[model samples]
Target: MTRRVLPYRTPSENVISAEDWHLVTPDGDIAAPEALPDWDYRMNLRLRRVVNVDLDRARTESGLPADAPLLLSAVWTATGSNLSGPAQHLRLPRAGTVPMKIDFELSGTNLGGLLLLDTALVLAERRPDARPASPRRAGSILWSDRRALRLQGDAPQFPMAVIDFSLTSFPDNAAWHLQISGSLESATMGALLLLVNERNTVTATAFANAAKPRQIDRLVLSAVYADAARLMVEHALSHEDFSEESDYPDDSLGATMLILFDRLFPDQSITDMRLRQRQSPSLFASDLQAAVTIFEVS
Candidate 1:
């Protein structure tokens, strides 16, 4: 059946919370591409975030062209916890010109207005002529699994597949790691790990060619339980269509929460986890750390 389609527009409301990173300082900015402070010459800055995938549904609805070789004009903004009045919009390419990639930066500065963070991204603008870039190149990492999973009955359960991730500066713990766990109610169903970062950017997103979420397990310092829970609950159920659903906590919310809780606190068990969420995270590896372990839910 042909799904309903609508013209996409920028979302009227946004807060830059979940997927956002910290700030900038005399030393350096959190999300900026700039390196860590010399500490001798500069004081460590606060936090300046670069929300990875801006999955702004309205914009996705309005901006992207309907057919192949789609040209999408987008705005990437970096807001301060300080609440500075304006955001920096990267200069986009002119209509006819195309870069080797869509590369841009989120720069921050210190007391003297010294540059703190400068998050540079070489994103690929989806075009008929262009080949695909890995998810890490397009945006943030969700979950990456080389192996498949079969949920066993157990606690302290490892995820059948794993959701790997990171914080602002690679190699360090900008935020805590999120450990996830999921279950398959029956033999007929499929298994997935839905990772979410709502408080951040909702405008920039990259989906795999297969249309499944990519995995990014190579980043972050450590994996913890609470972070895992948050990733799961805030997630939305999605389809390639991009215009069918209303936004929110959602129908599968209770069930998703239950699955997370059961995996975290396996003393409780569930049979069904089939409501829906917003988006799915895919595979990713950090430049900082090469190998992180994947968790499975028994």
Candidate 2:
């Protein structure tokens, strides 16, 4: 819950807001801090981002134990749109001593959509006196806080309790790295795996269609739909169980046309079904291509 701005690696662009930070330390074995997951270290950063036409991800950095095993995650939420995006996860190698990049992509061209991001990063090095224990489950949710990504759902709850997370940031050599660790019960882990697989399927389909069509409108439409699907999947996994059903748009082609309609005629209100009816197929095709400019990577 505590927040602090470090001396190194601050965003040059306008920062919206940042919070829900934690730091974890390696009590014994660096390779397996899973044993003593605690020992208090925490800090926070005031950072969050807004949707921009610019093609850069919000950037930040900190110094860590030159070469250490680490795990990092951020809760990315788009509020007004009712989309809780996934936790951007990264696993670092002991040999990686340079800065790492973390990215978040905006879905629709709706700059009005708001994004709130919360981060937790951890580094556990192997120690000479560390105790040997079975490895922690590989697919465990590292961020302990489930409250950050909660959403309203009508689905039934899981049969068992879900996992928990603990986060904090520790400093070494005058630099800091956020640390987070958590575990899940066997049933919860199984649910996570299932949800992850479903998300993968959804994303793979979008990518495939975007490539085959070779149309700007198709790519823009599929990209945003994929982003919304990703957000829903992230929201579902944020819970202890996998009962949450995502409500992303199933029709990327239709949604793209709608988005293009709004962008081309921002003065027009969606409530005007009459205006929508008047637009011909040729006009729709023209506007759709123009909207693709907003989604272009470069």
Candidate 3:
């Protein structure tokens, strides 16, 4: 009999209770920065982070039910270089809206890592009668990390209506191309990981088949980007894959990226390849951080 993997479930009850979620850096320091800014080049060799969002305006524009609890999801994935310091967590306010201050620490110089940010909101409903309870409440039992030997106990009475907001999804299923190019003289090496889907694969394959094999680097880059973007979109849709216990390249976005890269450079053997899902906790069910990987090539 084939083994069936269980789908991870997100906690919904008492989501607005204090300590339900938090903002922290990789080192577990509570983050209180303003906001993560879009890609910035002005910082030059130093790490840069910033964000400009009016939560008050966003809430008013949302037109959601007044009693619904508001949750904000933030994701940061590292690309090009595997530095092993990406963090993801949700924020829920006891009352009112989540704090707009988004803290991201990317200190140090000569940094050659690419970081991507994804943000969204989640609205959940709580049963007013049930008092909010902590995740590890008294009389509550949980399966151990061993996944065996059930510990029987009472289930928390707090019930909730949860909602999911697919990250990386846009209005009208439209495709987006966000690119920035600059001229800087240096000999730096890094790897690129991309997510592709059926649509992007078809489009990229068509373009690759039509273009000459010896086309300029610019054209080659565009083709690769197109294919990878499609794969990324598909991977995002299959978010459950990222929840798997093993985040190896073959099981994650890296597998699809390899296939596309082969089309881009059939003769070259890409070295030090990897595909990583930057997230916290094995069972934390939140699309707070996007899937990203960083590696290098000789």
Model number with the top TM-score: 2
* Per-residue alpha-carbon lDDT of candidate 1 for residues 40-103, written as tens digits (9 for 90 to 100): 1112223433332233332232243323122222223211111122223343332332232222
Give candidate 3 regions above 4 Å deviation: 1-57, 81-86, 94-99, 104-113, 124-298
| Tens digit per residue, CA lDDT, model 3, 83-110 | 3343333444534434344444443221
Supply every candidate's count of residue pairs whose N, Cα or C atoms clash at under 3 angstroms. Answer: 62, 21, 13
Candidate 1 — worst ten consecutive residues by lDDT sum? 141-150
Write down the lDDT that model 2 would get.
0.31
* Per-model TM-score on C-alpha atoms: 0.18, 0.23, 0.23
Off by over 4 Å in 1: 1-72, 75-96, 104-256, 265-298
Model 2: residue 42 alpha-carbon error in angstroms = 38
In model 2, the runs with Cα more than 4 Å from the true position are 4-68, 109-113, 123-298
